[model samples]
Target: MAKYDYDLFVIGAGSGGVRAARLAAMAGAKVLVAEEHRVGGTCVIRGCVPKKFMVYASEYAHHFKMAEGYGWTVGESSFDWPRFIAEKDKEIARLSGIYVRNLQNAGAELVHGRATLLDAHTVEVAGRGRVTADKILVAPGARPWMPVELPGIEHAITSNEAFHLEELPKRIVIAGGGYIALEFAGIFNGLGVETTLVHRGPNVLRGFDDDIRAHIAEEMDKRGIKVILGAQHAAIEKTDTGLVSRFTDGHHCESDVVMFALGRAPYVDGLGLEAAGVELDEDGAVRVDDYSRTNVENIWAVGDVTNRINLTPVAIREGHAFADTEFNNKPTTFDHDMVASAVFSQPPIGSVGLSEAEARHRLGKVDVYLARFRPMKYALTGYSERCLVKLVVEAATEKVVGCHVVGPDAPEIIQLAAVAMKMGVTKTQWDSTCAVHPTLAEELVTLREKYVPQGLGQAA
Candidate 1:
């Protein structure tokens, strides 16, 4: 048996690390969490919390414009970018302190420094020096992955810098096809920036369902965001006035700023995983089993570093599950399929389970239920915004394999869908239910009617 300095050594105090550290400490295990940066990690500092605030700030322009419809006299509307950024910073700082306090309250040692593997059983924190543990958890999440080359690449920024812009761009060209790209596009366009979304793929969001992607593209165009699909950015250069992007298709877009929502990669370059016998996946993410165990027997990983699912809640769950299984000997495991998620685009999106394409590709027959209509609130605002709900089911069993939605309050609405899906509710179950009137969620129940609820693969 290897005697160690602590029972659990946590690397990267992001969502996963913090949760694991706290849980392991509560289990009466000596825990030490090492964070190179802040306690709240990406989601709190850069990823979800900060970005969503930016999104909210961006949406106020529409709210202010539409206030006249509510019998309010509005002369003119303006946004103060500096004020929003300052408020965001203050909120982040407050949250960071809370995280720190929570760790201390749980009696876990918080080490503020970079962590590198000294051995399979040991890690050395820069400045703070060395520490050893019976088991080590790596929760080092991902960073925005920018392309490697370009002429004036220095002019391009990632999500990390997008939240702190001094002023909204007059013209912005956003690169990438991922959800980050779409979210940033929505934020920029909503704030009245002349936003051009340049996507290499035919659709903006690659991993989502085809219909959802197409719907968002249409809505983005409706919002005045130029959707340039199936286009690739070749190079970026600086003109005397602004940044210019040259596309492979012989067109150029000049913008005051260029941001890449380009996606993210495992932030595992400096943790010395190689020395610790931890293996990486094809895309350089830390490879781990379903139990969150790495190649190193006593070492485990969670969050974006593992690349299991890139959502914040997934990371937190995975981290807690790992601590429960390892420190508490609870034998718990993470179910990737059970993970539900939402995208905070202009008209937010949410999903749980298999996409329609995934269902069709994986199973010989799949049932699709789709519903689309304008929401009631939009009627009042004279906004033509639409909501879409789709369900994909296994043809033979009629198991509710997927739930998808796009429109307002998607993140909040998807949580209930996630619970229903977790309980194995089928199309028949949904159809037999009553819907709350004039709400977007009723669309879920409405979609079930179109599914032809006769069990999957059943003959007419």
Candidate 2:
């Protein structure tokens, strides 16, 4: 018999924590999982799943426009915020039920409440008292963070509130240049709201490749979404009509809504990790080693709380690794390299591996191949939106180091590229693969020319 009451106790029933708990339980360890909010955590409950539904809803407005060029007489249409919200709520509730059922099927007991570590192996629930475990896993995840300096900041809604708006605003002012902010801007604009994106940085998507950042901004402009660069919200005021935002650069805009998708921070407060001797990094993320183990031997953390890779899939992998290492005696660890990601923006973005700039700086003497063209669907509709395909290669070894795509189905295409890159597929190998005719991805394998440095092959 085990010395502790439970072999494993998991905090936060998000993707990471839930996976760890279920797997540990299946391994025949007595496991208990606690969640204060919804069982599915950020991605399933409030983040990716719900947000992607909004993205799909927003895209219909564009479809109606494109349908005209294709000779489809689409009748006048209207979008009801309440109807969509209700449907989304139903779908979310169903998913939450599935998550709970899965855990139960795996023989893991679910406890509902905010759980805090009382010591290394003891966790105290808000009303449920204490539970002792041989090992503990913390996957508390992150929360949307907002700026505090602006006055009337409380009036500004974060992404969480954006999902449940009573009515769609006529005009919206969104602050932040990250993926979340840009995505919402597209969402509101596509839904017929006057959307204006304001960023303190010179451009949106600060960490992406320069070309991608500029291209997305251009596309947003073409869609009539105003982009304000190098400025921030100085203050906000509630007027009789709605809300008004004053920028740091002396510009002001009035709108029915103001949202800040600035970023997210690890939800560590009140978790009692400090009391349990688990250390956090400078950014307040739970500090974990390569194996996702905290300073305390029995306590481990995964997902956004660890601040490794904030994606939901990454968290799932981390959780699976934890169970394999501790229970199955497999000694597994998650490899963060060559992971692919996508942004569900107006056109969307999908990328993997190093950025072009990062590759150039690190490898030096890199070769670049890029192509821009309209997809066949766009051509028939007379739509002008174009797609970009780029490949960055190490010139010396001919190994493809990075792949970036901006256009329709980009996320799906990049997933294939990610698999190839993980296997160290070279530029030559990519070229040898037969191109799938009449497909957007064909452009990726068909690029014959490499972009050369301007001065290198010239008169000099």
Candidate 3:
């Protein structure tokens, strides 16, 4: 008789859990995955996938303007919120189905219910009874956080609700300075909504390069987004006009929608982690080792719940590594460094490795290469929009430690740059590459002069 119901019982079928389940099952381990909500989790259902589609839809407003600048006559354009939402939901459903199919094809059984750890090796599903496993993996991911203490906060929504909003708002007040807040601000503004961004910080895109932060904020203002800094929402009150967001400074703004993109927290509440004896960090994230093993030897975790590099790709890699270590007899650990990331805000941003400030702080003296120029596509269009490409090289080792971009195709450009940086490419090696003619990416290679910020002499 088998000692347990399955070899592996996976909780939360997000990207990480799904990948681990599939791989373990393929390795001849009996695996079962249980998800309370949709199988696709945040990225596919409510987060990145749907958000990117909205970004694409919102970008047409600029395309129309650029077309006119290029001397091409464009017709009257309109956006139907209901139509877009319906189409987006359909595609999300299709993706969710694909996730389910992939798990089954890999010989992994799945259950549709919330699974809570009853013990180190036991999980109890909502509808189903308790199930035992030799090993268990938790990858419940995270949820958008809202300040519950604030007055009338219920009137405000998060990015999750933003996707399913029935009607388009005439104006929106997005609170936060992070990528999610900025992305939605751009999305709403591009769709012709009067958008105002409220942040407690002095600038948007905190933790990004200072120049990138200032440039994006300036561009956002030029793009018609009212960027309010060093302010936070004190209250949100419903009125006949719409929603009134009262700031801490005694001022207020009325908008049809008030969104709190404050950030996300790992979804660990009511998960019965206490019963399972799983340790959590001070931030409420599951505490795990590099191999993703929990304090309980038979238990493991990955993805947002672990809170190490919360990107989806990182989660998938962690899951694969966990599966390899436990099932394939090959120990593996994901390298969290130099992971490329992109923001789908207006004009977009792609970045990899350390920020300029981080490089300077860690590596002491650093050489900075920066280029800001109008992209060729906007040359004839007469648009003032400019692209920025910057590299931070360690002065001692001459290694390119950071690459940041804020402009057209920045995400795509940063992805390739990440590959070279991951391979420990140096400034000379990066410069040796020939430039691709008539391309925004060409500016990366063509940068020769080192940038020295005013007041900071020599290397920064």
What digit string (tens of lDDT, one per residue) describes model 2 on residues 1-460?
A: 6689899999999999999999999999999999999999999888999999999999999999998888999998999999999999999999999999999999999999999998999999977899899999999899999888679998999999999999999999999999999899999999999999999998999778777888889888987899999999989999999898999999999999999999999999999998999999999999999889999999999999988889999999999999999999999999999999898887899999888889988998788888878888787677778888889999899999999999999999999999999999999999999999999999999998986545557221
lDDT of 1 by residue, 1-460 (tens): 5478889999989999999999999999999999988889999999899989988988887777667667667777777778878999999999999999999999999988999998898898988888889889999899988787766778899999987888778999999878788888888888888999898887888888888989988988888889898887899998899998999888999999999877899999979999988899899999999899998899999999998888888899999899889778898988887578888888889988888778888886877888888887667677787888888888688788998999889889999889988989877887888998978888788764445434544431
Q: What's the CA RMSD for each of the models?
A: 2.7, 1.6, 0.8
Per-residue lDDT, model 2, residue 280, is 92
User: Which wins on lDDT, candidate 1 or candidate 2?
Assistant: 2
lDDT of 3 by residue, 148-192 (tens): 999999899999999999899999999999999999999999999
Which wins on TM-score, candidate 1 or candidate 2?
Answer: 2
Instruction: Report the poorest 10 consecutive residues by lDDT, candidate 2.
Output: 451-460
CA-lDDT, candidates in order? 0.87, 0.92, 0.93
What's the TM-score of every candidate structure? Answer: 0.95, 0.98, 0.99
Candidate 3: segments with Cα more than 4 A from true spot: none
Q: In model 1, how large is the Cα lDDT of residue 169?
A: 80
Error of 3 at 295 (Å): 1.2
Candidate 1, which segments miss by more than 4 Å at Cα?
448-460
User: Which stretches in model 2 have alpha-carbon errors above 4 Å?
Assistant: 453-460
